[model samples]
Target: MADTGLASERPLRSASFRWFLGGQSISLLGSAMSPVALAFAVLEATGSAAWLAAVTTAALVPMVAALLLGGGVADRHRRDSVLRLTSVGAGLTQAGVACVLLTHQHPAFLLPLCAFSGVFQGLTKPALRGIVANLAAGRGIQRASSLLASVRNTTKIIGPTTAGLLTASVGGGWAIAADAVSFLLAAVCFARMSLPDRPQRTADDPTMLGALREGWGYFSSQPWIWAVTLAFAVNNGFNLGVWQILGPVVANGTIGARGWGLVLSARGAGALLASVVMVKLTVRRPMGPALASMSLAAVPLILLGAGADTLWLAAASFVAGVATEFFTVVWETVNTTHIPERLLSRVGAHDEFWSFVPIPVSQLSTPFLAAAFGTASVAVLGGATAAVAMLLPLLVPALRRIEIHRQGE
Candidate 1:
């Protein structure tokens, strides 16, 4: 490990950073509610796996499509400003969905509305990544990232259960409305933030396309970024996308709704524990360690596919969550140290786009695959594929050798 001086110090002592963290903590908690709520809502509305896949794919399409443009916009403008504006827009979109659903109307436009929300939310990604790197600079990016993940994981513990209960009691539409309110609150918090200015550019500076090209150039040149992203594209196909589509079904049928909530909370509990550990833990040769951690995440998938009892499944999910956070912290630390700050947002956008592009495919095909091969077979196959994919990037020497260094060192 390269010298990360004074790793013992905490970054949250900075008031502005604290506020940023606080706002995000609340926002993420609320945002966390949406996934379970939305999944169950669609499942209830149509009772078809295909409908769930379609809605999810609709949301991701716009998110993936607008990523490069979003990156360019974030790099060119004030990231804080971009974040605030996008947050408000996203809140409204979600609120709109809630109202439409609350009126007892058919969800004729849910897909388009979700797509619009995706666009706004997508634009915020590069800005969010840029903001974190700026605020955490030289104050121990690893610790800072770990702290952020800790906040999110903590919410993940509460959010799903909250959403599940609310869905059981009030309905998923209202739960989504709560997520909208959280976005608005996050927007207010963002509006109060102050950060260092970005680099000034003259009229002769690169066009949006030119900036995108530059970002792709930088991202592609880094063997670690591209290689890891390629692996994640496959990993996400199996883990995130497929899991999202199938989890609710599995949860409802086998585990019961409340039982599923407990299972998810168990996963979140493990993630929370991992993040807490990451706050004090620093690893050398992050690539190999990260991959090793990620390989363990497949355990829950295997257990779920086998229709293990709730207790065993939750235990496996908890362990998988712990392994996930290990990978997440190391990955963020590496990227923050390696990428140039000016291009971080754009590079992050490329990273997000490529890493997540396969999600819609994974989600869209999950139902068909499940129908064809049976959900158990699909789950096992996906989980096995993910385990294999996580290690593939290790074969690249550049990735394995990558290390972090303090900025001025």
Candidate 2:
């Protein structure tokens, strides 16, 4: 089977998987464009960060609320169908936003429309994560994950640049409309892909609340999962959420606007390189390396805190991106291989919730923290805390002793 390239391990050989990759690549590129476009739109509409924050909050709250239920729904139906439906729903909401802005309608509609978009986006998360297992044909899940990561990293570079160009040349409405088009294309691809339906719910099976409880129970039973999830809640909150706010502030002041752009470009390049490297490198023991790779990400935060020259900061950022991507591939591979397919999406949603719940808090709190401790101090503290938090998971024997490949075991 391997020789004929029809083996389950050969994900690239499957036409449906190729289409899946193409659709996801385009979809992620659009998602990447949206932030820059939306930020500009809100600012143009109201000229206030307060209004922008309100719009963002409206989107995030519903997305978080819907995650667990979305996971349940993914397990109850065909994952491909869910992906297609959510893509259509989300595309319509984005189109509505584009239309409202084009006609110069009252900004009030933007809030609800953004919230509606978030609902569909939230519904897609579990299905998105779980679909790779179905696509992998019982093998090559890790390869598929690496391929997806590579596409995403490449798009992160292209999306923002395209968004900036479109928003400046035309308008934010047009840029958002482009995103809507991408979603429609994604829906078309999902519609074409084939996947098996999930098991029908039986009388003995859990209700939604019970399913949530079962997922939580599975998570709690695994010390590694819980430890890592708790650690990442803190790490992501500071490294990602707080940085999303304050990093730009610090970069604009220290490195200047052009320099900050260069730093981001370098980080994206590094992530692309990591994805390419992981194509061949298999992790036998993933846990220790995954934790260590994540800890390395703190160095860039510390570098920024020190107000290093742009060159130094860019180099650190590049390294941090590489480590972060490496950690991501390893983490996803472990989950896909180890978790039961029937419960994978629900458990994944719980994991996603824990990782994201702190993000909003961090975003809201960053300004206050910076005001209280000063920006440099906040960066230093956040970086130190992230390193400590990630490493704490290593204290668990299960985490340190685990091997991912499992062939010998």
Candidate 3:
């Protein structure tokens, strides 16, 4: 495929990309709501945080385990078809959860249903990456990614609030039902998309294991890709633990829950603003800027450790959000432009899998670390570690050398 100049061809002008964007926007909104609704439903039914934790773990573990398999499947089939099937599967599982909640309220029933839903969720992730690359060739990748990020940030603001209202009025079951419907509707949109044909696999094609090994080889060979992935693996763990786990405790002592909520809102607003700005701006070489921006993430954690006022914390969070979103768009665009289409899903899966592997560890260990070293101390240390992780990628000469050119250039 020839490079499509960003000025000459806007991603939205493509009917297929429009369809993709519309479906993903709706689907993401529902996904954002699902966790809130599920949390309330689990509490209402079981009345135990332990059970809720178990249910949540059940869902997440399966998703993580399935990621490599999902990547393989996505690479083997049409990406859109994979999306359609996974959406249908996820929708059905959610419907089952709704039925279980509405009638018997068997908490154990949720385990299998949510586990299956998580599997479907895992399957969709890599296919989503592949489909976006297919729909937005060349420089349009950045525009498409920015547009998608904008919708995602907007939904993060709206979806939970909507779910809370629905849960309060009707019930958590009904809110989940709404999520199920959204997935099914998204499946319809996927069915309607017109994607280019993929090359047919021959009998001589490598087996799934072999294909995965091939993907691993390619991923490892690219210092820019693996280096960034390694940095994120460390940075995300510290960021999540400090910001999500310790920040709440710090808020209770200083800013209060309401203040914490406002700070989070500011972050979302900042991300949305960055997404809008990135639609017009072009970065020929994104990795250096992306890594540099990621260091901004440390500010809010350090502020919380310092016992800053709510306004100061919120200001830091807003900048962090802008930095996070900017890095995300640039990272996605880099992958789409540089990685071969055949291996894109596999590489993306590896990136996501490693990035997520440390999350559970952080979630599990943060409180222990806090109890031993004190919450404020841990937050400060975490922020410093994250900043180092983000900046360390700059030391890799290969990562710093990567560049993408505009079509006409």
Off by over 4 Å in 3: 1-8, 36-55, 96-109, 164-175, 241-263, 301-313, 367-378
State the displacement of the C-alpha of residue 27, model 2, in Å, after optimal TM-score superposition: 0.3
Scored against the true structure, residue 321 in model 1 reaches a CA lDDT of 91
TM-score leader: 1
The list of candidate 2 runs beyond 4 A from truth reads 1-7, 40-50, 99-109, 137-139, 168-171, 248-262, 304-313, 406-409
Clash pairs, model 1 backbone: none
Q: Evaluate all candidate structures by whole-model CA lDDT and list the values in order.
A: 0.83, 0.79, 0.79
Please tell me which model should have the higher TM-score, number 2 or number 3: 2
Q: Which candidate, 1 or 3, has the higher lDDT? A: 1
**What RMSD value applies to candidate 2?**
3.1
For residue 192, give model 2's deviation from the true position in Å.
Answer: 0.4
| True-structure Cα RMSD, model 3 | 3.6
Q: Kindly list the per-residue Cα lDDT of model 2 for residues 1-409, writing each as its tens digit.
A: 1122452477787776777888898788888777767766666677654455567767876887888888888877889899899999998999998898778787788989999998897799988878888877434777888888899889866776676667666767887888899999999998887776577778999888888788888977998788888999989877776666666566534554345556665676788899888877887887898898888888878878777887887798788879889988888888888888878888888888888887777767776788789878988888888888888889999888776673234
Pairs that collide in candidate 3 are: none
Number of colliding residue pairs in each model? 0, 0, 0
